[model samples]
Target: MTRRYVIVGNGPAGVAAAEAIRRHDTAGEIRIVGGEDTGFYSRPGLAYLLTGAIPEESLFSRPASDHDLAGIHRTVGTVREIDPQRHRIVLFDGQAMSYDRLLLAVGARAVRPAVPGIDLDGVVTLDNLDDARRILRLARRAKRACVVGGGITAIELAEGLAANGVETHYLMRGDRYWGSVLDPYESALVEGRLAEEGIRIHRGVELAGVIGRKGRVAAVETRDGSTLACDILAVAIGTQPRLELAHLAGLQTGRGIWADATFQTTDRDIFAAGDAAEVLDPETGKRGIDSLWSAALDHGRAAGEQMCGVGRPYRRPAPFNVTRIGGVTTTLIGAVGTGARDVDLVTLGRGDSNAWREHADAFAVVSDGEANHLRLVLGPDRLVGAVVMGDQALSRPLQHLIRERVDIRWARDRLSRGPIEVRKALQALIERTVPLGAA
Candidate 1:
């Protein structure tokens, strides 16, 4: 009898796992169970959809026909329980499905504060398609909006609301935006750009409570005793891993579901990935949350490959992040260490182009003057981490450096000296990787 492979959750990791499993095991039964009502779509594209830049139909990462043609069964439902001993899952409807191998890709959900009036109308959290749609609906009639948090999601929400003509206010507990990924200088540059777009930013502020009128949010009270009047309150604080199922099933979890290099859970037959899985960063050697879409896809693919008897060890790469807010584009790779020991600081330009660089083995180049910055962290002549801003032309090369760890010190030194032959070397690298047609 052919073995059955069951995957829970329909996000990027879950979907990618199904495709990867089919790649190695041609005849095995593959079933994907997800709590989402709609089929798989790109989570990152949700922000774009709100801006009307992309149609809802365009959000689907894979066509429905693709799943059908692959002989994969996609079930839209919730998995309430996992029975690792029996290698089975119990759905909310009490239906039990046996599996020879199970993949737990149940992603994280938005964390709402425990403050009062959270249940009031007009307050929303964007975690999935449904949440996005609801927020868009509220945006249509919203005059004033408040976005709470300081991550990429908060920036996206604040910008999106402002674009729709809503009076937007960004509430952050930190002194700078994206404090985790960006240095103080880069954060200031981004903050300045948002301010130019007419978005008011309040730093070092916390959401104390929500004042409601007629069961709808009227204003947001901050811990500083200042209240901002708004028609909508969007909570983009952060996400908590959905580990109830994993914990209940007796799987080892800390910070996130603990998995080895092979992406396997404590139970040999079970595996976990995506936002739910906490994997170590190869560069920092620290347990980190990989909420990015690319990381999740790679995690699922690795898990699936391992499940299919492939003798492959999962390679955890440095984390990469990219975001555009108020027409400013920023890309970050690896951790921008908090203090001085792990990183060295570099600055380029003054005023608008001023950006702070942090690296020990890593080098960051910020051209805040030209709205451009590039950070490269080298490990034994290999690029480990990088951040690019303004000019995205160098993103591909930076990504290549991160992947191949190319020795471009000669080219980098040349650019530093007099900008003599940097373009030639960069073009050569591009030609080697990107196809001529695409180039």
Candidate 2:
């Protein structure tokens, strides 16, 4: 009998799930439903698009028709609700699709502050490719622009706006940038780099409300009792998962739709993944959500295999990412602590779980300098987390140690000895655990 598999949300997770299912069961009927017509393009690439590092057409990783070659059928529509009992989902147009098994990889939406004039024409959030195009159009007429929030996206917004020859102003509520994730030194490094690019920084300030003229953004008022000329206000605060369908389906949800290690939700036949899923972290034994492309791709594959009746449990990989911060390349590994909630930077600073800040209470050792910086978070007997900036010599080794729970307790006592021993010790451990050609 040919089993029918229906996957919701057309992002990386949904697409990966369809491909994975095809690989496992050739006869299975796989259908992917998404609201976006662009099919699958790189969400992370949207940042580079803003900076003009990549052409708009270059944002596509593969042609939309590529999925048809793999025998995956595409349906474009917004799902209104899911009825697990009937094994069917209703589309917004009142169309319905039934399935033997369903995967909800719905993803998330960018958040903006709730204030007056938010509905004005000039305010936007850099969430999707459409938003990116909208910003590019607005930048041409923008005399001055302001970016609010912290973390990588906020910085990218400031840089992208400044690159268009518009005067860019960055507003942060904290004294330093990304206070929760980056230390004072790391914050200073990023903050200083932004200043050199002609981007003005406003620390310890908040957006009280926006003032509009003719129903478009004209100026903004800060909580500090000051007004600034701002034609465009880009918000990159954070994101919230879309869970209306999950709720309608009667699935258990919290930070996101709750799913087990196999990506199975409360309803056995229904699964969730991507940014929309609050999944179990194989390492920490805690469930959390992620808004990253790599994580979503891996998540879809695992859930697809499970839907195909793969008996093995999916071991979520460590949060590994090599990203650009203010033109500097950096790599992030497992469980580095989180900062205060005000930073609103949920994208990269944390790990597989949002509770990364709980581990922040632990002590850390640092290898500090002008450009290169490394901080290792040590638990009682192993490497819990690490933050690598500028240089990446220690990144791969530290990732292995933290991900595998290798005992680096011996190095804990040698904290005062310096980074030389730290690097040597990590290399030794990687040699023992990783194979010759690996690491």
Candidate 3:
């Protein structure tokens, strides 16, 4: 008898899992369930779609015929509940499906702030293709738009709105943008670029509420007691993993659904992936939920292979993400988030107030700035992480160094100076480490 597999969610993780299952377990019955009625669409492409850079049909990552050709059964409906004991899942529409193995790739949902008037008609979020379409339509006629958030999503939305000739206002409660990933200097660099693009950025101001006129947003009221007129309000605050189903099923969860490196939940037959799954680090015992597109694809492939009787711990390559904010390209790689407790940081120009030298050994800092800036997080033995803004030519080399954990101790003094010196130092290290042809 052929094994039956039911995968929930049709985002990157779900679709990748389906494709992987078809590749590895040819005889298995594969079924993918998604709440959306459409085929696989690229969530990231929604920004381009809003800017009119890409057509609606181009939003789809995979055509409907791809699913048909793969012999994968597609169903549309929300999975209301999972009966783990009976190995069955019930849809919100009251349909039941049984599976030998189940994978939850439910992804995440955009977080709407708890301010009043958030439910106003013109207040929207870009999560799905539908949201993109709505925003595109609104942008064409919008005179003024306000985007609230600090992450990549907010930047993308603000840029899109500005591209469509909408007067855009970016509001951030923090003094610096993306303080979670970038330091003050780096944030300033990005903020400068955004301002140059004619975006009005309001820093250190909280979003008090939205003011609606006839059920449509008329203006945004800031906690500072100032009102800014705007017709469209886009919130890209962040996203929270959709873990209600897993929680309801009694699955162990932390920030996300807890899963081992093998993508196995507490129950051996049930697995989780995408932003919903938290993959634990064996050495540090820390669970990391990488919300990047690459992480979802990697997790799905690994989970699918493991489910097909090939058990191998998923090895995450160094996390990497690239984005264009204010026409300046920024690339971040490895554990660049400021949240890590064990990580140390060092900066070139700033006076040494870093706590790492007294307690821990490894750290990172903004090394140098010219037409571009380079920040490096150094471990005891290798390059741990990096942030690059402008002159992205260094991105590839830095990525290899961080991901491959190349030794850079030989050029310690030179590396401490900043970008230009660090580049030279890295070149020296690369010559010794990588083969001539490879370099």
Candidate 4:
């Protein structure tokens, strides 16, 4: 009998799992149920679509015909319930499907602010293609737009709206943008660059409520009682993991669906991944949620491989983030200045447009003019995490260093004097993994 593999959700994590399962078991019956109308598309790229940079057809990870070719059955609907004991899923359309193994990748949902006038028109949240389309339509008519949030999505949306000739205001509760990911200095640099582009930023503030005019959002009132008039309001506050199904099935869930090192849920035969799952942080020894695309894909792949009987243990390397704002590219890898004793600081540029660095204990900050690159080194010579802004060329090497734990003491000393020989350093690091004969 052919094994049955049923996956819920069609995001990056779920798609990667399907591929991983196919690699291990060529003849298994694989089925994917997705809530979105489209199959797998780049979640991060949805913002670009709002700006009309990419066509809607190009968003999918694979062509529509590929599903039939791969011998995988895909159902477009919502999964209302999951029965772990019986290994069945109840769909929103009242259909039930039994599975030998089940994977959950339901992802997360946007967090709507709890305030009056939130139900007014011209208020939107960017969570999917439909949401993006609605926002794009609203933005076309919006003269002044206000984005409320402090996360990366808020920053991206604000920048995109501003680029489209919309007067944009970014409101955040923190003193700086991306406070959870970047340090104060790095955050200031990014905030400053956005200001230069004529985007208004309100720091250390909270949205009191949306003020409506003619049944539509006309302005936003902050906690300080200051009102900013805007034609549209975008809420990019954050996301909460979609764990209702898992919770209903009596599976353990923390900030997200609780999974072991191998991506297995409380139920041994069940697994969860992507934005819906939370795993232990190897650095902090505490459970953490990584909502990045790379982490989600890796988690899905690992879970699928394990389900197919591969004995690969999930060894999460580090959390990393990369984004481009107003033509400035930034990458963040490993850990930042969180849970540190002392930090060694370095700055490559000056003012709100310079690269900033904060190194303490095992962490290092490397930035160059409006682009902030952060690298967190953990335990001896291991590179644990890094964040780079403005230059992606630096990310590849930085990622390699953090992943392989390359000892850059020699390179670090020479970097300040002049351009350090990256090729030589990489070659030296490769020697550790590759044999001399292969080299």
Candidate 5:
């Protein structure tokens, strides 16, 4: 029998799964149903689009013709419901489709706070390409903009808006930026860079409510009874997985749809992947949720193989992401937090996985007294995690050391001596231990 495959949410995970399935089962009937108007585009590049760093055409990852060439059928509509027992899905427009296997890669959406006038015309989020376009349109007329959040998305918005000539005011609920991930010195470095770019940083402020005039954002009221003049109010408060469909279809879920090591969900025939899959971590005995693009791509491919009866147990790699934060190219690998916790900071990051916070241990910080910064999380016998900011000469090496858990027991004492000694030791260790073939 020709296997009929139906995948939901045509983003990176869904699209990657379709291609992977096509590679293995040449005759499988693969249909990708998505709600977005456009095809797959680089979600991370949306920041570049806002800042005019890259042309709009550069945002797309897979060309539309690639899917057609691969014999993958694409449909656009909102999925009204999924019937697992019936092996079918119904779209919002009343169209129904059945499949032998179903993959849910619905991804996630940015959360909007429950503030008065939040639904105003000038209030927005940069969740999708459409949201980025809307933000650009608003930036044209926006004189002053206020953004609240403590992660990468919030920084991207503030930077993009400032680049667009809008006087941007970034509101931090805590003392600094990204407190959950970046330490005090790291946060200060990012704050200093953003300040140089003309972004006003307001610390220890929370959005009490948004004030709208004529059905558009005119100002925002802080918790301290201060009203700031604002034409645009952008919110990048964490993201939540689209789990309503999974819940309604009788699938068990916690932070996301629960999935086994093979990416198989509670139901054998249906699978979950990407940001929506709360995959089990056998090592930690906890379910892991990821909002990273690379995680989605890797999981989607492995999930496709599982659907094809390959039974490839998805091997979740150590989390790694390289991004420009506050105008500094930063690379984060594994876990780098120095046991610092911030409830105000959103636990989930837009470009990071919540799993990075799973292992927090002893760490050391090194800097060049400028924008360049490096921090290493140490384990008893190996390197656990790292954060490389500014100069990234050590980024890939750090990732390899942490990911492979290379032994550093010989140099643990020397590492704690000081910054200069630690740098020399890590440079020599990376050169000696890491082979060129290391992934």
Candidate 6:
């Protein structure tokens, strides 16, 4: 009997799941439903598109011919509801598709906060390719652009606006940039770099409302009674999982739609993945979405395998994200921000290593005078979390140590000595764990 597998998205996760299903169940019916008409494209590449690093037409993850070759059926419609009892999903257009197994990988939607004049013509979000095109059009005559929010997306938007020769103002509700992930020291380093790039930083200010002139955004009004002139307003606060269909399906949900390690939902036949799925950590019993591109791809593959009767749990290392913003390479590994107050933080400051800077510049161009800071989150006796800024050489080793739960007790004294000796200490610890020949 040919089993039917229905994937309710066309993003990285959903596409990966479909391909995996085809690989395992060669004769099974595989269908991918996407609300967007376009095929899969790189969401991360949207930022580069703003700076002309990539052409608008080059965002697709794969060629148009590939989906047909894979024997996957693609549909354009939103999954409005999941009727698990009937083993079918109802589309927004009232079309119902039945499946032996269903995967919900609908991803997330970008948010625009409710404020006066927010519906004005000049205010837009760069969530999808369409939004990117809209922003590109607006950027042509935009002189002063104000980006609201303190997340990575907001920072990237601000950088893109500045790169396009527009005067950029990064308005954050908090006093520090990325305060959730960065400490005072780390935040200062980022703040200084942004200032050097002529991107004005306004912190601890609440966005009271947006002011418009003749149906177009003219200025941004703050709660403190100050209004900053702006030709465009871009908001990149954060993202919430698209879980309306999951809720309608009567699936248990928390941060996102709850699924077990195998991506199995409340109904054994229904699975979930991508930004929409809050997978439970088998070890800790915690349910949350990793929301990373790599994580989503892996989850889809694992879920696909499980659906094919190859039982294996989807296990992932602690979450990490690396990005170069404002000419500074920043890497956040593990639960760096969530439990910072509980762990022992080791701060190492390396003030302008000319040699190190040159080495790193080859990979990613950073600010000329930006200082490097490496901080490790040590829990009990093992390396757990790390924040690498300016210099990313330590990012890989730190990630490995955290993932492997390697003990760094032998380098405790050397680590406390500060920046100069910290690298040596890490090298020593690595050499000890690894054989001499391997080192």
What TM-scores do the predictions have? Answer: 0.86, 0.94, 0.91, 0.85, 0.97, 0.89
Pairs clashing in candidate 1?
343-359, 343-360, 344-359, 352-368, 353-368, 353-369, 362-377
Best TM-score among the predictions, by candidate number: 5
- Shift of residue 161 alpha carbon in model 3, Å: 1.1
Pick out the ten consecutive residues of candidate 4 with the lowest summed lDDT: 346-355
lDDT measured at residue 25 in model 4 versus the true structure, 0 to 100: 91
Tell me which of candidates 1 and 5 scores higher on TM-score: 5
Model 6 C-alpha lDDT versus the unseen true structure: 0.76
* Tens digits of per-residue lDDT for model 1, 261-355: 77888999888888888765445455556777887888899989988879477666655666685577877665444333211011110000101
Tell me model 2's lDDT, rounded to 2 decimals: 0.81
Task: List pairs with backbone clashes in candidate 6.
Answer: none
lDDT string for model 4 (256-367, tens) is 8998877888998888988888875555566666777887888889989988989567877645666675456766665554442211111110001111123335644343
For model 6, the stretches where C-alpha displacement exceeds 4 angstroms are: 338-371, 434-439
Poorest 10 consecutive residues of model 5 by lDDT? 338-347
How well is each residue in 224-326 modelled by candidate 3, as lDDT tens digits? 7999999999887767778898987899998789999989999888999988888887766767777777778889988998888785787767778777766
State in Å the error of residue 416, model 2. 4.5
lDDT per residue as tens, model 6, 350-407: 0100111111111111122237777766655776677788767667777778777777
Off by over 4 Å in 5: none
Best by lDDT: 5
